[model samples]
Target: MEFDAVLIEPRRAAMIAAGLWLDKTADDYFDACLAAHPDALALSAIHAATGARRDLSWAELDLLADRAALGLRALGVGRGDVVTCQLPNGWEFVASYLGCSRIGAVFNPVMPIFREHELGFMLKHGESKVFLVPKTFRGFDHEAMAEGLKPGLPALRQIVVAGGAGANSFDALLSNPAFDSQRATITRDTRLGPDDVCQLIYTSGTTGEPKGVMHTANTMYANLAPFAERLHMGGEDVILMFSPMAHQTGFMYGLLLPLMLKARFVLMDSWDKALAARIIEGDGVTWTMASTPFLIDLSGAVEDLGTDPASLRIFLCAGTVIPGPVVERAQRVLGARVISAWGMTENGAVTTVLPEDPAQRAAETDGVPLPGIELQIRDREGRPVSGPGIEGGLFVRGCSNFGGYLKRPQWNNVDADGWFDTGDIARMDAAGYIRICGRSKDIIIRGAENIPVVEVEAALFKHPAVQSVAIVGYPDDRLGERACAFVVPKPGQTLSFEAMQAHLKAHNFATQYWPERLELREALPATASGKVQKFALRQLLRDEMGL
Candidate 1:
């Protein structure tokens, strides 16, 4: 079965020759890990809402994974099929992903926060065959929504509810005796090669469309070793993952990284700071990766509890700059090496501070590129930015980088020199550490989540009272950014913030995507060509807030 993805031959050949793209999949490492440490802990799952814990050994998880694969097959899922799973951080999510990888099915993980507006587009575009979600999560009926949308999606063949009664129940399917009987015939397929695209993740692009970022096993594996080696991670180290497994940050380092290292990981279904702080000390969690707000909250919780989370050694935070005070306090309180980093859905954690670097380095820069990757800054003309400390568009090309966007090979956007435009503005110092200055993508990195500014604006265009609308982000101390909509009302008509929100709710947008504040304007500042001048609007908010 052929998977849908773009694989440039020369690049793949070069990476393979250099041994960077190890012709191995997560299944290979998982088997090796089981052989080496059959009795060792593989997952420590804690439900954030319930404070419930479940621990599984590597051997047990492997068994469940096999069962899950059989269950998926029974539902007509096969090689190269797109299976979309919308689950929080839990054992079920882990099992589903592993099952997909084992059977050469492309796992498309949807963030739980997405509602019909965002999710409908993705489900339709990917032509997903099987969708997995909890019966209910965070007070939302995910199963009900999936069932409602199924009629509209002809390719969506099955819906597997994680916690519900029925023939399609996820738990019941995994525990079926018939699948266990077929275990004897379950041979690892040699044809299920590392180069096959195993993952499809959607990231919002500048055009207000979600781009499906595809990754092969080799591309992802290339990122793990160099990153782990530089941080001195090993089988002995303990990991805690609080971020959603849907994001590449959490997906790669949280799930697959632990499997490759053959180490144990704790899954936090929600980001509960108090519980996380307690888990660190109780579980001896040594390594974690999250965004700025998490580090801030965790440090605060540690201080409040007056507990020394000495087991935590590395805390890698990305998506925004870490304030100097936050970094210092987190180190002083938690005793973890704070690492500032930057990455995209197209590539996972391309830049990160070294373990040996001083705390001051994290505050000053996002850090240098990882192994098998190269970073360059270029101008509008595509010429390399001449000197260090000069701000320009950042470009990245690496073995870990993703293939062309799903179904749109022309959107690969790589230049003749093989550099993919990162859409971030940055400046590299003489020391090779880069500081992110701005984004050309017109994006708002609110906390770790990328708020699709243009998409939100387009949604508001449905509002009858809205004559013109533009969404711009204002600085927030904790979340890094918060969207505020500036609008011009239709003549002789008025609009209110409540009305605007009601309109978005009708459109089925997630509450997180709604603009927090509304500002009325007589007219918007635009160019001669009538394109909205977003930078000027951002400056307007900055000046009004005295930032």
Candidate 2:
């Protein structure tokens, strides 16, 4: 479906006027590689658990994509249809994405860790026509879960399975008899364009259900172009990506960016610092993009396991704040440049520290906004604030900025002037660098995925034993933060952590959203308006944790 002109015309005119919107699509680059240098290594992977490795050259990958595209065509998936893939980091995801792009279908990636609750909403909301899942991943029966969800998903016509028993096997699809004819059909009149939607990545906000962030080919290109240029990435570089492929960081840098640069990309489906260190040392890895936890674990692995990652050069850390001392320690221990970055699924890599940025800048600030993007701070009343150190709401507008959330006009999260409210409180220095101080929204970012605080609290409030509940983030040295629930039980009632977790499970909430720690409180701090003061709760926890 075409985007509403009201959302497209202004952003399009601005981006085109600035020459930031490249008219090229991702398929265009891969198609060029097929003709010029098909033998080049484009993607490599080491299983996060099994330690098995798989490598795919550009020619092999492109051919597999053609067959997958044919398989999709046979299933009636065409332009504008959504293909949701919940596979781990592997060649299957790469093939699915390429095939979808080849046929003008939108590729939607679901995190492997997400269960029935998350998948049910995303697939139904996205109107996914074809859903792909690994039969089993990390010991969970994803195939069974997908089958159970099929009855509720009216638009889902096919469920393709990878590496396990299912109605359709991914391996057999690669050898489908219709592949050649379908390839010809796709090449005849490919309707995909730069402004066409490429992906619909869902991310949680202050709300309960996650919002699908839409990105067109041009928007993604705008981000990948600046990232590659700034990092000076090329075919010679080997990227070790431990972030989930479903997340934007891994989706862009780990999956698409390497293909764009004709470089080697290594991925780990699960995060294991010891395994990651081994990959870095064995594969001659040069750079990676992940969150703070990965940095901490890798640093520890280097020191404790005596792993030599001397070939690693740059580590782009995002998802959460990196403690200043941790950044200093990472540089000294890993012998790599620790670069800080801040971005969301709505726009990939909006602001990031440059390769040559000072260590202090990387630690103290989130870095400057990339070219073609504009960042500003405003007060609660929406008036622009001109200052160096004053904290205000952060807003951004750029070529890479997303158009709107899927099927939610009221939740567009943007103003009439085309600025997106980042929901972050930040300060901009005189030199134009931004430092995020806190969040203006009620959400906790646990290991890069946002936990909808209100949703969880609302569910917990339904419990018979609970009187009042507030959820807040507690500092953690590894994960950066974890959810801690403070509950005031009803008189003559007691709530245990096990019972609370059981309640959440019964409510069909993802385990990741469940509070890790439970604290019993006699009363919670409140305001004159009878609303819970979460800041007080957070501060109390901070003091208790001595953070």
Q: Who wins the TM-score comparison?
A: 1
lDDT of 2 by residue, 43-107 (tens): 78778788888888888887788898888878899999999999988888888898888888998
Off by over 4 Å in 2: 1-6, 174-182
Question: Weakest 10 consecutive residues, lDDT, candidate 2?
Answer: 1-10
Point to the candidate with the largest lDDT.
1
Deviation (Å) of 12 in candidate 2: 1.4
Model 2 sits at a Cα RMSD from the real structure of 1.8
Provide the TM-score for each candidate, comma-separated.
0.98, 0.96
**Predictions in order: lDDT:** 0.87, 0.85
- The true-versus-predicted C-alpha distance at residue 69 of model 1, in Å, is 0.3
lDDT of 1 by residue, 1-547 (tens): 3444665455888998888899889889899999998888899999998899989999889888888888887788888888998989899998888888777788999899998888888988888999998899889999999988898888898999888899888877755656888766557872257888888999987777888888888888898888898889999989999999988888999999998899999999989999999999999999999988999999999989976699999999999889999899989988989999988888888989998998899999999999899999988887889999999999999888887788877788787767898898999999889999998887888888998878888888878888999988888878888989999999988889999999989888888888899999999999999998888998998998899
